[model samples]
Target: MNRQHWLTAAVLGIALPAACLSACGQDRGGFKQIDQSFSPDASVDAPDCRHQCSLDGRSIVEACTGTVVETCPDHLACGGAKCIEPCAAAAEDRSSNGCDFYFQSPQLMKRLPPSCYAAFVVNTSNQPVELSLELAGEPVDVSKTMFLTKPGSATLLQHTGPIPVGESVIVFLSDASPEMPRNIEWELSYKACPAGVTPATFAQTLTGGTGVGSSFRLQTNAPVSLAAMYPFGGATSYVPTAGLILPVASWAKEHILVNGWEASESGSPGIQIVASEDETEVTILPKRDIQDGEGVKGGRAGRPAKYMLGKGQYLRIVQDEELTGSIITSTKPTTSFGGHSCGDVPATAATCDILAQQIPAFEHWGSEYVGVAYRPRLGNEHEAVPYRIVAARDGTMLEYDPEIPPGAPTMMNAGETVTFRQGTGDAFVVRTQDTEHPIYVAAYMTGSSGDGKTAKSYGGRGDPEFVNIVPAGQYLNAYSFYADPTFGETSLVVVRAKLRGEFRDVWLECAGNLTGWKPVGTRGEYEYLRVDLARNGRAGESFGESICQNGLQRMKSEGPFTATLWGWDYAASYAYPGGMAQRKLVEAPLGSVH
Candidate 1:
């Protein structure tokens, strides 16, 4: 960079320290030129005004005497001062009447890398001005002139070559002297060159389809764009530019952060980008069957079962069996059978019996004669049939009869009552006595009977055979029942409790406290019992009495025992009895109860 200054003067004069006066030719006598190279001796006579006086190539003319001599052309102004063009003789000295000319040029413009181009400025004045270039706030190598020519002047300069990227260079111009105007303009241009270009690379790539396994790949020095689509609509696209790519390990973290799909690499070689259905969330597993609600085990020959989608939304990759196209959603709840038969047969004769052969002490109990039964009714007609009553309650197995009794209730009315009972001596005696008991009942009507006897038949009723019974201090367990033919429909088992001498309290506990127990059918039997803490009266009230049994037995020697109750009524093809029993209670340490 270069810095320069210029100077200008208006008045012309030549004064000697101590000298006498002399005169030259008098024509055009008011003006005189002076030579600045020479100085007058003290004994020499200096030129007065006009004539032949020279100092620094300027002269003091006699145009104005005693007041101050004026300098004209062809003279070196003493003390390096020069005259303005078209100068005219003046009568008196004017303090502000000095040099009136100004110097100026176009504003300077610059770019980096000196070799690329050059810049310059023009000075219209009679004086010359110096120029310099500064780069990045520092001066660079450039030419320096002792003096610049006056007026109608121009200077061309080049910036230092090999300028690094991102550096700015500025061109500065100034007059060599302070007396001159610094009004200089600058114009800058650079050589043509192509703009720098960089190629885009792959930074991250996500691979996965909706409801399918997906993976991601991240690469250095690469740009990546990702697009995702869901079952409903297009998801989102992720594009990372240079310096904006996320860390590679972020994609492998558990529960990775993502706008929609998260990235992970914990169980896979590549980045695992996961997305889920709006209705279901999915998990990524290294091997199949490793998801929740599934059993993952080593397969034959040490290989693992291939990953597959189970009932819910999940993604797993395994090595063994193929799991493609095996995703099932909304599987039905399962029902297990334990040595039970659903066909029509006597409980004792059936190959698969629900109850173990053991007679209860209460042989006259209303549940003893009950058996599982099926009655098909279409329109106003009744087509009673026998079904092997699987014991829902645990107890002794009873017999079942396919033939309906001669005087059994008919289905002439829509809501007519049908009564069925069993027992060697009297069935009604036991039913009419015990009015307080919980019973399980279920009813279902089918469109057709497979027996071929009826085109459209509806039958089958029974409460859920499985019940959860909790002892005061013991955890709840399955309390099942055995079915006998004495009970009607098997589905109509009603639980009723007898109170006082007249069987005044016949009720069922559905909700809330025991005060809200509703009356039940006294004639029917209940097969299952789900017992929770019975609410006594007010909130948190305790119901006293510890001996509780609803067809389940707690033995001191044996852990827990189960019984099944099954039966059918005479009105149906067979009697279907449904009820449960509770064994004798045993005392245990209060602290040991659970």
Candidate 2:
């Protein structure tokens, strides 16, 4: 007996099949088992080990003897050949690396790590299927394999791992071809498994209609996985709704109202509105029990509300239902008077000497004074008394200060009497008519000599003697001169003047010039004036027979030379003995030439 006898005994005890015993022990079968007991000289052929068997109507031969055995049909093993039952199909495998996958109705879709390898069994009649993965919006290719015709089938596919960090992916499945069954039922498996990757878990599902202005809040008890999304500064899409209105002091973002609706992260804290090129965000007003207008108003009255005016500054008003008015005040800088110099006067001593004559004519004289009284004119008097004295020839103007030297008093008063020494060039004396009342006096010198015209005279003056006697609030005339040749053949040199008075504490002085005067007819009666010019004939002319005397007489009662006296009642009365005083008046020196 050879090793085949032992194999046959072992097979009988194990309830072995007939084919296994015949193939293992006999040579009649196509398989031949080598003899293991032969000495070194033993022949290679085995004679008693031949066997045959039939599988699915096909014959097979086997020979058994030693460690090496032979059998017919190279693909079949006698003892190992047995009918294998189909196993349950494996699950389909999928891989995604920061990518995504979507499945059609019949095909199963899944998201898997790059290392995950899966197997899928194809037991149904459905044809092969195509799988696709996408990232952002682009596609990626995976391994390809064919399905077998066997009823129970399986497929092994390699899986690509997680997409590189900071990236995303997607995967999808579909029929390999349109002709194939739409329902692709298959099982898949892979060796690799999903690693550290986890599925995305959000506290709340994203609602379909949610958008930019919508409000939302994170669900309580949900583990915060900030790592889930990129650009973690904060998500603009989701906004907190309730407690978000008043966040903790440490919360960096601010809340606001936009277009009458609540908005978030609007402007810097403490500010009500935030504006950008694309949108405008405004702070939400605190809900209060008070009515709408109860709170302070915002932009109005040409200013911003407690804030600097910026590029887009505009008025935003808050009003009650009644539309009541609101007042606003702000601060700015100040403006006051700066001094100016009065122009020059005429050159002639006579013309310039009478320059003091124009002082009181200023409309502001009386009221500007302190502790002084100004009686514009004699009791109920209508006629104007000459307060200003001027040169008959060239219009040289002058002012007189009887009580004080020129420029002595910064201020002058009505009823002030100013006297001038007969031949004192341009010098004159001024006296404040009232004890303490004062007014302003200014003088101007104009015109050029040998210009075939006289030196133009312009100034302001009033009589201290008369102004002091007239009652307060009385009227007196003010005078002015204008150089007009059109009204008369010779430049008429019309001294147009007016008078205005006020009982107020401050008085205003009227303006004047020789070229043109303020017309008395245009002003109150108190602005009227009486003018007179005494003249002494030049040598070779008869005494008291010159044009100056005639002009004086003509001006004595009426015309531009006439003016009312404010205090004529207080005029000094001095009656000198003999004709000495008379001669002084008659022989008064004439105005000197330049």
Candidate 3:
């Protein structure tokens, strides 16, 4: 295979050994015990009542049908069963409420590479939203307003003109629906632009929405790109492509690491970066690389590109030859991608090639994330799907579920990554103690090629792909997205927290031919369901590429949840692109009563 194509397998983390595939379908076990102090309130905690109160009596209407809870106090409003104040009640807390939000990065001249442009996404609720732009604290008029009316939707806004590098710009979502909570979500990003022109194309997927702000310093955008190599530590080459990485603030700095292996595996893995043609001179630093003479060295023993990149120009470097993690610093901002040419995880009996991911610009990193490990093809559980967590700053802390006590990494430094060999479990939750500096998280499917010959199974097909975890803070109660018209084995993976109750109801409507849901398996306090779009309706008619117009599916639920879609053909599988949802803007504290 062409070396560049090898990166595709790495991008998905596929190519697991049969041992890995055999471990895919582990029991959906129970959750770890949570602190009672933080538990959500339900009528079960109310005063003596022989029977659950009916709304006709002192009952509060709940999310699921045939259910009732103790009535809320006079001041509290019924949100499912818990009595909570209206979202508008906390209107003054503009920073925390989802209804009204703002994005601002001070003069980048001092912190970011010069002449960097910005990118952002705005998630709107059922109602229309209005926003304003300001620079250096002065209002700037915006002429374009984009919308996606397929149920719940988000709009991506890329500033076409170069933002004054040294000046600050603020985009505020101020006008929200009065009848309903504002439910507006936004994220900011920056990328060093080429001196004389923009890169031919741009890439990133919208990954988060819903929820009030948890910290003013947190930056959250969807995972738009990822690249990996094959056979663990092999050296594969890639055709260089230009992209952007915007700094979060003037203080933005990052640690990049490229995993190293023995030189016998093709060659040593390495990383390369080019400066934009615009007279931008960046200082390149050589950090830790394999120290042994046979191992990859820092900057791979110095293969020179340039200390600075000019407009329309590029940079390239190699160490261990695979681009896992390597640091890049510039006098101004810069743009780039991360991945490998070929490699495999879990020593699998499948294809051993992968691609790279457009690294989510450091400016878009967040502290909380929710994700599901990729599953082996049906009948191929021997292939164990896995996931990894990479820290973006020093002293970054982490906590996750399906509890890993003896193995979890609580403290991480810049450029460091920890992989949890889950070999099992359907979903996971990772949260950071310091929101200001969040880490990067990714899920890789155990390797499998639908050809179905090796794992001793009838069901199997396609290569593997990586799924970017959406931040938990961005979880939404509603989602609308499209499935590729050409991909096969398309499906949706939905996960929800059960703190609110044993039953969290979700409604899904797709292709105008199906409108209902099937109960999913539960692992502790979490409930998850997988819907195979291809198998939902009359085979090959309502679904499976036949319903492109109807391919737009909408999901809404009584509680907040996150959903990601994956599609596979006879040879490869990928998380559907350009999907979006809305976060909760006005719900009360999980267990708080008015």
Candidate 4:
């Protein structure tokens, strides 16, 4: 096997064993427990009105003919109490109600590495959606926004031009009221452009979009998948970072944060929160003292600090402190995102770039995860990258493939964190044995400077960036995603699951079949592939071939799979999952919402 192609499944406590195919055996799927059978047994009628409220009992509605639960999660219509998607062709997939989405580009930097931001919204709905862009504190032409009428079609949210990097500016988007029943997916991006390029010269996707903005909130009447890019570096260079934006429906009151690479001088890695409802009260128990930033007050470590934000308003904090394991609980659903302002990977690498990921609420944290290493700069043999692990509960224990530094390390308490690097050049996997004690992991790309001499430079190989590792249990069968045109290279990393010990085929709309998927670890059911997109600079390099369209593309497979987008420019880069089902895999112990 090609050395760079080998991957591992990293379990919690950050354990990622080398070649688990034999050891993983048939028990790989049991890493976590997921109750997908949301419906009651068919042919068994409801006992009576008295038993209707039992988790698996008939609904309280008069009919009592369908599933016991009021609604089937993952959008399924129950048949004889079995949860299934509606086969009857209709205007839209009736399983999702994720219409309202809110987005805010994080404060990616505090200094030089200048760049711009952009947003993409893909129409996954069956009917045309009259879409519009909304924002305040800045003004430009908003009339260029168009109506999306076809499925799989995408459009750029129109904007005037690149806004300077500072506090995030708010952008709002939504579908026409009449088009309430719909589904859409959106992605936000940033491209490395010349410092003084005219407004007309900025890079754009195939579908010319509304330019870049700081933050955006969308209130449509359909379900939508969203993601964003966090790129900040000198003009012509960057370190791209991305996040799989979850639907607002899954946004919750409680969250535990895991931020990326940190260096004191670059600026602090921090949190950005946006209010979804009026007069929302949010309290933060910072793991480190938060240095106050725009609209946010600094909070003492381990001390509770409160802030109030109105609907659509947001708070951004970037400083020198590390915010990992910080606890944030809000009174209403509020969108939250976090990442490092700008820092070098391995600290000594040449220049610095940004890192950011939209934080999934504690309820959405999954137990089973595969830690696939980002592609190393081919020919450089620059194989090793950094990994950070954060524990969500007390007494969380973890083990890894090959132990290093604090051998057999474990989190001594809830909200504890452990940071480590992979055995230089080796790709590892980390899995959690218990679902009740789920954890969060962030994968990081090292700096471009091989020896730590360069600084404030552009296009120095790859700089720094990070994305949260989405768990295997949250993989989806199909995805509508886009790659930012701003980067010189774009690729998708896929983790495929097995069915009865056989690997299934994955299809990328333009690339036909995704070939060269290697088995992951020791499990017969998992495989991993890192395919460069159609326009990647290294398109024809063996396993590095472009698998599909450069941007605004679609992919599907016979079984569940996870796709993460990665892109890079001079010294710039960004990465984020295509999308993931926001499952409530782990929940707060009863009555303890925070």
Candidate 5:
């Protein structure tokens, strides 16, 4: 691999200098405080602002700058994140971000690679799922599993494994009844260009009309969260991208797509929409002109085009043009995804891979986020990965801590996007001028060559994979995540913040201690660290059989944090955020979800 353009972080080992360590400062979450006595100046413009503790036991961080004038949500009073007011009390019904029901389906993604799907059902409810269920229900046999996250008791490591997927399936508790609404959450994983499949339908993507074409009708008695990982495998040109799967209750009428640039003969980049309710009407306003191919029609650039879809039906818009700024709105709640069928990161990267992520509605967007890269493309530690920030509202002014690469836009219009590379083995925080201006940020694993390895540090190790970076304010303290144990390697990146200038620790059930946290960037006093969870070269490889049952894990912390899961092999790899709080950081239409 080439090393000419990679950043310096000591190629062989990590070089965390003493000056990069935080000597003093409140280890609060992503919302950097002004010149408070507890921490150094987070902003030169607001050096005089400070935080005070109320006699009633609540924290109040006054805005130090004129630009910050937004009010906190009903549950929060001061500062911008859940970390500041550690002792504040408020009435919250946040049992867990799950719903009584959810609608889900599957996709083929690309034609070249044979695909297989797997799912991990998480018991987000406080009560244990003591019984076994099958079909669309959770396919977990509690006895062989590690054990679910228990309430008010010593933690027991649980590994329920991945549920097998087939046809259009429903995910609901067998015991669920209309009188008792239960919520559940699940993660979807796609094994790329796999070794083999017994039958062709094993990796089939739902095609054709309504009911028969529909996927999951997740009618639960409890709340549930949904997300997916689209991974492409083979000997080369394979990578993964993942995003939070928004439930129908949280869906909005409108959404904006974010993606990397790619216009090669090999793959095309574009947006896709899936209908939740029958007879859903969708309109697309493409950012660039699209060309026609296969049996699909093309939407003219700069013009609004409409399409009607039935429940479980999906639309794929593949083209040579970029779709980063495209806008899609529906008459009813719908699922929207964006990425390349198989393409390059910058149009010049030697190879290309599949990328697909379920996008959150515009209403779920946030202004504060922290973006970090994977360990260092397998072999190269100094490799600098790429990241992009997309604006949800016009006239958005972006601010970045520790500076940004030149040409990265500080001012952006709605549907506009800006790209910059992540610093060598580091993380960076980006926030809008205020809370009203929401944006979406994503991280991408650099693309590699045919050998599954590129020439330079920035070039290859794994292939191209991209994942949405859930903002800090939307981060949570608990997560039920799974890593595919079949890969040659599997690992996670855990990013946590401090509360009230005090240090906080997080625990991963599969692993001990959750230590060795290093500052994200040179600005250590900023109070953030990029910690590794699993970096071993191999993770007990499993073939096509029950993938998740072998790789499930649970993580917990005292305060909000973010975890990203990724795995790589010869030339195949996948990446996605483990979980997110995804709170109501921005305004949404009526009946939107967290």
Candidate 6:
């Protein structure tokens, strides 16, 4: 998989020759004027630049040395031609020599197949630049130098192998970012690696304590069966990853993605798929035990029943009972991940072990959320950090921050669920007043700290983990994720929307080397900050230990923001919920299409 096209000579500047890259300048009616500072006989230079220009200087661009270049309508860089000005053209576009920002993806296996792609970059700029990579266009020898760290930190590189479909994946910023092209932002998250497996390519920056998520987690000590599909079927559904199944019948139903539960004798485990062409109709309701917000209603949840699953086949439920929240539906698209053969999540007494993640699909659910609850461990404030809040649509009307009125829940119809036990709050921001029908919150932590209460407190047994929240419409003035290096204690809660007076121009930049941050609580527009990232923790310690010690964080914002990351070590715990690496793994290659 490697066709390599990589183009963006600093925003397509010098690629030329498609007939001079489309007519090379001087089109008058279409505008292109330059010459107010005139006086450029200094031997010649500016005959290239291309974006806006018309203050009146009789257009005339032709310099491939054919010389004639004298333009600048209103777009500066044209009177001579060495060209500059391009942070996307206009906010006063600059760079006589600086600000650079590029984003290229050509196809990365478009529509799906050759698989295994990975490219994420988040330097949301404030300084510290130089970060290059280009595969089809050459240049990619490991080039580094990115410091200036703080706005949520980020850097996962992986990609020197599998890519097959026309191939192309460039990500540049090789030094530019006087806030150019908005500094930097990239994303690509391929999948499909089955035939012989082998993933992981080369460039590995991932960066200290990573934190953005497409819902990843399948750690291993032994048994493992985590497989997720979808090479190209997102952005609403193109559904064609490459056979085996996925025609989606006609798609009017069926979309459970992944909801396995059960922690002990091993229960809760289900994965469904089908659609090798037609007759889709896949289903699974098996309530098994259902109790974490019990038989959810409006969003429909009685469970203990229903069946189906045929078209192409793929279903495997694990031992005993308790298929924790299992649903699985299908009318069209399909992709699934198996669950707990070994278990552990919110059980906490000593260690219950094993948990996996990778379900998301309902088009990557989101409707505004923030999490950091389940507190405990640090002298154990009596324990509390359980969370579940499902409901993809149907009337969804949940809300919470400091007020957990009966624990907040006014509606919740489609797929219904609302559980929030364990309250020692310091961060929770549930939201759902419609925001175009989005609701799928998730947060749970319980591995040990058994002393917090009885059955061993926490989740009341031992071992439980699942985190999925970060949906302020996928907020992203900019971001980069991948933190969970596992040293433990890394906390960061940040949730923003507060706009009123603009909250003093809001701030939080993490990667170019930190910046103002302050906030511990504020409910209305939502605001909370609490950072720690573990360098060996200890700033005001209540429960701080080695959090984001540079496993990759790179955050960003001036107004809209989103974040969530917890990493406990009392016994075991790791959370994730920060989005926007192009809204959860690249779909909006450049547009804004979460």
Highest TM-score against the true fold, candidate: 4
Clashes per model (N, Cα, C within 3 A): 129, 130, 86, 48, 30, 93
Instruction: Kindly report which residue stretches of model 4 are placed more than 4 angstroms away from their true locations once superposed.
Output: 1-97, 108-115, 136-141, 145-215, 230-240, 292-295, 380-382, 399-412, 423-427, 452-459, 499-502, 534-547, 590-594
What lDDT does the true structure give each of the candidates?
A: 0.19, 0.17, 0.35, 0.51, 0.49, 0.35
Better of 3 and 4 by TM-score: 4
RMSD to truth, every model: 55.0, 61.1, 15.4, 11.7, 12.6, 28.3
TM-score order of candidates, top first: 4, 5, 3, 6, 1, 2
lDDT of 6 by residue, 217-248 (tens): 11111111111222221111111111011111
TM-score, per-candidate, Cα-based: 0.17, 0.13, 0.47, 0.70, 0.66, 0.24
Predicted candidate 5 versus true structure: per-residue lDDT over 491-544, tens digit per residue: 577777654444457766655446667665454533443333334443332223
Off by over 4 Å in 1: 1-342, 345-448, 454-456, 459-492, 502-510, 513-579, 582-594
Arrange candidates, best lDDT first.
4, 5, 3, 6, 1, 2
Per residue, candidate 2 scores C-alpha lDDT tens digits across 364-425 of 12211111111222222211221221111111112222222222322222122222112112
lDDT of 3 by residue, 356-413 (tens): 3334434435566655543345643334555666666666656565554234466677
**TM-score of candidate 5 against the unseen true structure:** 0.66
lDDT of 4 by residue, 1-594 (tens): 000111121100012212221233234344443332211211112233321211211122223322234554533333333443322211122111245566755544432212344444454433333333444423333333321112212223333333221111112222213222222111112233223222211222221111122445554332344455443222243445566666566687888766665654434465677776778998878777877554456777878878887666666665555676778888897767776655656554545566678877776676556667655565332356567777787666454333332322344346766666653235345655566777787777766654425322223555677877776556656677656554556657888775324566887766677877776455345678776662345332233344343556577765567788767656667787876656556645412333
Relative to the true structure, candidate 3 reaches a TM of: 0.47
Candidate 2 TM-score versus the reference: 0.13
